[model samples]
Target: MSKSLLNHILLLVLLFIGIILSLSLGSVSIPFKEIIKSLLALSVENSTWDYIIVNYRLPKTITAILIGSGLAVSGLLMQTLFRNPLAGPYVLGLSSGASLGVAFLIMGAGLLSGILGEFIFSKWAIILAASGGSLLVMLAVLSTAQRVKDTMTLLIIGLMVASLTSAVVSVLAYFSNSDDLQLYIFWSFGSLGNLSWQEVGILASCWFIGLGFAIFCLKNLNALLLGENYAKSMGVELKSNRILIIVSTSILAGSATAFAGPIAFVGLAVPHLVRQLIPTNDHRILLPSVILGGAILMLICDVIAQLPGNENTLPINAVTSIFGAPVVIWLLLRKRKLNF
Candidate 1:
């Protein structure tokens, strides 16, 4: 088999292994046999065991897969759109926007004498607030992008936006009471286990909408890989492509942040890793690889976060950053130059 096919098979295998490990080896340590039996409805000692499998582990596992795939693909699209290897979902301040929104709600409620806290703390309210923040930032970026053709300029603008929002978040954080501060800090760390089936369904819907948009942009993405001028020569509609990319990326990154918080590095690291492994610039090949590679890494991260055989789980963001930051540094050091 060709290298791509072999690599694809390898990723699938790793994904399967990761799933099995995620399901079987948490604090309670359900046996692999029991896990399989529970999944297949063969047998279960009690309803609680089934609840552990179906209600908790299954939803968490699905969240990991979806968040991973969505963020990685968003990063790929951003990098391609900007032709910058370092560009990612966070690069455009999208996640920062989500963070700012959550900060506003949590902190604002805390300062309001607990009157609106109940309403603001609702799951849908949080998700909606985050989505709105992300969409607002996306619009700002797209508007600025219209005036700036240089990718580096666009990147700098995004950084400025991130800084601005971060400063606002800091101000909110400083003024907030200890309880609200703790809540915001915990959410910022990221979590995959808090989602329920209904929340997961909403996330899945947003993910599919974003992924569908990305699929529609595949040809334009491939063309733009050569450069905007070349892509324009090839009949790619630059303006339209940018709008669609912004919309898709907003949904993907926004929804993930809303549900799982701002997951770091999966977006930044996964695409580069896929490119290194597959050695292809074609979006057709790269997109699926991006999804699989993302899911695999996320599963591993989630498993590690669980601290198997123990009750304490690390934050998903910390695990991803610890694992991803080194790969990025090594990649940059070895190449001595960014392809973009």
Candidate 2:
């Protein structure tokens, strides 16, 4: 077998193990045997164990997988589209836009209730707000992309747009009641455990469609890596591909922030981490490799955040940056140059 194929198979094994470990090692620490039994709908000895597995852990596990892979793929697209080693999904400011959306819902919902009604108070409301905010930013960026010739110039516009949105969120927070402020703070810390199956289904749908865009653009992505002029020579439609890339990024990054509350480092770190293993610029290989690598890393982080036997858990957002930042630094230092 080819070496890359062997590596992929190994990664698949690791992914399976990560999923089971995430299921088994939460605060209550269910046994692996019981986890398997519960998953198959056979009763565990304790009803609470079954309840916890079905209601909490399963949805959470599925969420981690989606958030991890989706964010990583979004990062890959950004990195390739801009051809910048430092480029990431957040560079486009979709996260900030999503944050602004959720901030309005959480901090300003009461003021808008008479005008917009109670729709802002629903569970799905947060997701919609975030998506709507992201859509607005996406439209602005798309408009800028059309006017700007240089990709770097377009990236700069995205940064400015992101900054404006972030400032607005901060202003909203300053006027918010303490209770609302606290709710926003906890949401920013990020959570993978509270999603219902229905929320997961919505997140999963967004993830699927976002990935479909990335998959469709794989050829253009690889061609664009060398240069846009080169890609043009190769018959890649620059404008259409650019839209696909941005829209895919908006969907993935936006939905992830919406559901999971702004996970840090995963989108930026996972693609680089995969490059350290697979050593490829080809999106076809990098996409799947990064997807699995992202899911595995997220699962690992989730396992640590659960704090095993302890009742208290670390904030997942902090845990990701804590664990992932060091690894990324070490990898870059050892390599002495980023792959891309």
Candidate 3:
């Protein structure tokens, strides 16, 4: 096999190892043998260990993989569309917009009861509210993208929307009850543990749809990298392609934020890592690698968030920022600056 193919295989193997390790490592540690046994019995019988493994750890692990892959794909799409390596889901303020949506539900609607509520948001109402908020922002951004011709202008507008959303969230927080405020604060910190199986299913479905759409647009993305006029010269319809990319990115980023509460750095950093590994700009290769790289990074971050030594788990966002920020800085300082 070529070195590149060999490396990809190695990475996939490592990712599988990471998933298994994540399943085994937690507050209540289970032996590998028991974990394997539990999986075998999952369909045939019900046991205490089976419930724990299937209901709890399985969902968390699946979420980590899904969110990681979704965010990474979103980042790649944005970076390609903007022709800016630094353009990530978070950088464009999509996460913040999602946060703002959740904030409104947590603060204004007082809907904090249900599966997530027991540990976190704790309510279906909050989840719905947050989803609504994110959808609204997605629509707004999509509308703006339709009107604006310049990619940089769209980015600036996104930033402005994010800032406006943050300002609103601040005002809401200022007036919110202390109990609600604390919940909001924790939600903002981000966690994979917040998702239940139903939520995981929703996330998985959305991710699959978004990824499928992204794969279909690979050729257009490649054409885009050559510049808008060049793409047009090649008979690539800019308007429709742009809309599809924006919509796909919005679904991926929005779902992740609504569910995971804006886990940081995975979307922004993983694509660059994949690019470095592959040493090619081809989206066909880069897209799949980005997904795998994202899943691996998120699994690692989820393990760190649990932190076996500590009674208190670190927030998912905190762990991501600790690793993500440095990579982002390096990308910014690289020889070829992102023009968009």
Candidate 4:
């Protein structure tokens, strides 16, 4: 086999090993045999081991995989659309938009309860609100994308919108009661442990839809990498392609943020990591590699968050930022001459 194909095979094997290691290395360590038994849906030799693997470890691992794939794909799409290596869903404020929605839900819950007189705000309600908030911001960005000819200007506008959302969230936090404030603070820290099975299903559905759309646009993305005029000459409709990218990216990024509370850096760093590993900009290979790479990185991070040394888990966002920020800095330094 060619070297490139061999490298890909090796990477896949490493990723599989990473997943298995992550599943087995938590505080209540389960043996590799137990993990395999759990995966096969067999009754583990130890019943408690079965619960740990099946209930806690499995869900956490799956969540990391899903969120990682979603964020990485979102990042890749953003980078291609803007032709900026540093572009990511978080940088464009999709996560901030989701954060705004969640903030509103937390602050407004008391008002909602007072108004409805004994009706509690369900998890579904918060999720819907967060999705709505993200959708609104995305629509605004999409509208702005049509009006602005400069890609850099659109990126700046996204940042501005993100700042505006943050300002609004601050105002909400100021007026919020202590209970709500504490809850909001915890949510903002980002955790995979927060997901219910239903929420996971929602995130997964949105991720698949977004990923499918992105896959459809791979040719256009590849063409655009050569620049807009060149893409136009190749019959790639720039406006339609941009719209498709925006929609897909918003859904993928927004859903992850809404459910997981604005986990950071996966989108921005995972694509670059994948490209470095594969040494190709070809979207066909790059896209899937980035997706798998993201899943592996996230699973590893989630395992770290559990922190075997302590009973308490670290925030998922904090762990990602620790890894992601340096990648962003290196990209910036490497491309110092390139314009955003």
Candidate 5:
């Protein structure tokens, strides 16, 4: 068997292990055997364990998998599109756009007690606002992509938009009450366990559609690694491909941010980690490897965030950034440069 194939198998094994660990080692520890039974829809001896396993852990695990793979794939898309090591899924200001929408909804909340207020303050409102904000940015980026001849200029435009939105958010925060500010702050910390099955289903739909776009652009992505001129020479339409890349990224990153509240670092780190492991530039290999790597990393991070049997769970964003940064730093130091 090829070495890459062997590595892929190993990653799959790690993912399976991570899933089991995530399911079995929560605040109330469930046994591996019971987890397996619950997964298979078999009755467990303990009803409480069964309920926890079937309802909470199952959905959360799926969420981790989706968030990880989506962000990682989005990061890979951004990195390849920009041909920059430092570029991340949020480079196009998608996350900032999301934060902007959510900030307005929470900080500018004019509603207090009525049904309208309840609807405005509901979780769905946050999700809607975030999605709306991301879509606005996506449209802006798409329009900009069509007009700009230089890719670097598009990146700069995205940064400017992000900065502008952040400034607006700051203004809103300044005018907001303490309670609203605290709510916004907590939202930024990110979460994985809060998703319902319906929300998970929505998240998965976004993942699938985004990944479908990624798969469609696989060849364009590979050709892009050489250079835009090379890709164009190979008959890749740069403008259309660029829009698709941005769209895919916006979908993946935007959905994750909207639902999970802007969890950090996974999109930026997973591709690099997978590249180091698999040592390939081929998108066919890179995409799947990054998917598995991202999922496993997220599952592990989620498990760590849960603090395993402790009632106190860390924020998902905190755990990802806290642990991911050091590993990425060590990898770069060891290699003395980025692989890309």
Candidate 6:
């Protein structure tokens, strides 16, 4: 077998192992046998175990898979589009923009219970707010990117945008009641377990559409590796490609931030990690490898967050940053340069 094929198979194996571990090894340990039984629809001695596996564990596992794959793919797109190794979904300020939107709803409007008055939070309202905020930031970034000559300059602009939005959020939080502040704080921590089945369906659908766009842009992406001038010489349409990339990224990153609350590092770190493992620049291969790599990383992080056999869980964002920051640092030290 070819080395790439062998690598693909190994990644698949690792991903399967990750899925099994994620399903069976949480705070309440479910035996591997019980997990298998539950998945197969076989009767288990304890119905509660089955319920926990099917309802809680299953949804969490699916969320991990979807978020991981989506963020990784989105990161890959940004990296390729900008020709910058460190570029990620957040490089365009999408996450901070989403946070700003959510803060407006949760803090500015006092949506949380006991904040100022009795009010129930609506999931759709939050989603729409988050999406709208990120989309607006994306449009602003895209416009600026077109005018910028240097990719690094565009990246710095994104950081500036993120900082500005964060400042806005801070001001909103200061004026908001304590209860509302707490609500926004919890959302900022990020979680993988809060998604309902209906919400999952929406996330999954958006994820697939984003994936479709990525796949369609594979050839354009590969062409871009040779630089924009070379790509245009080969008849690649830069404008259309950029628009598609921005749309795909907005969908993937927006859905993830809206649903899971700006979980970090997966997008920024996963593409670099996958490249280290696969040692290829081919998007066709890198794409699937990144999806698998992201899923496995997310599963491991989720397991760590659960603090196995304990009642308490860590924030997903904290765990990801703790584990991923070192990898990114090491990658930078070794490469000592951006590919672009």
Provide TM-scores for the models. 0.94, 0.96, 0.90, 0.91, 0.97, 0.91
- Scored by Cα lDDT, where does model 3 land? 0.82
Highest TM-score: give the candidate number: 5
lDDT for model 6 comes to: 0.87
Clash number for every model? 0, 0, 5, 0, 0, 0
Q: Write the per-residue lDDT of candidate 5 for residues 277-315, one digit (tens) a residue.
A: 889899999999999999999999998998876899999
lDDT of each: 0.88, 0.90, 0.82, 0.82, 0.91, 0.87
Instruction: Write down the worst ten-residue block by lDDT for model 4.
Output: 331-340
TM-score of predicted structure 4: 0.91
Name the TM-score of candidate 6. Answer: 0.91
Which ten residues in a row are the worst by lDDT in model 1? 110-119
Model 1 / residue 36 / CA error / Å:
1.2
> What TM value does model 1 have?
0.94
Better of 2 and 4 by lDDT: 2
What lDDT does model 1 reach?
Answer: 0.88
Candidate ordering by TM-score (highest first)? 5, 2, 1, 6, 4, 3
Which parts of model 6 are misplaced by more than 4 Å? 110-120, 142-157, 328-340
Model 5 residue pairs with clashes: none
Better by lDDT, candidate 5 or 1: 5
Task: Please write out the lDDT profile of model 1 over residues 263-303, one tens digit for every residue.
Answer: 99999889988877788889999999999999998999999
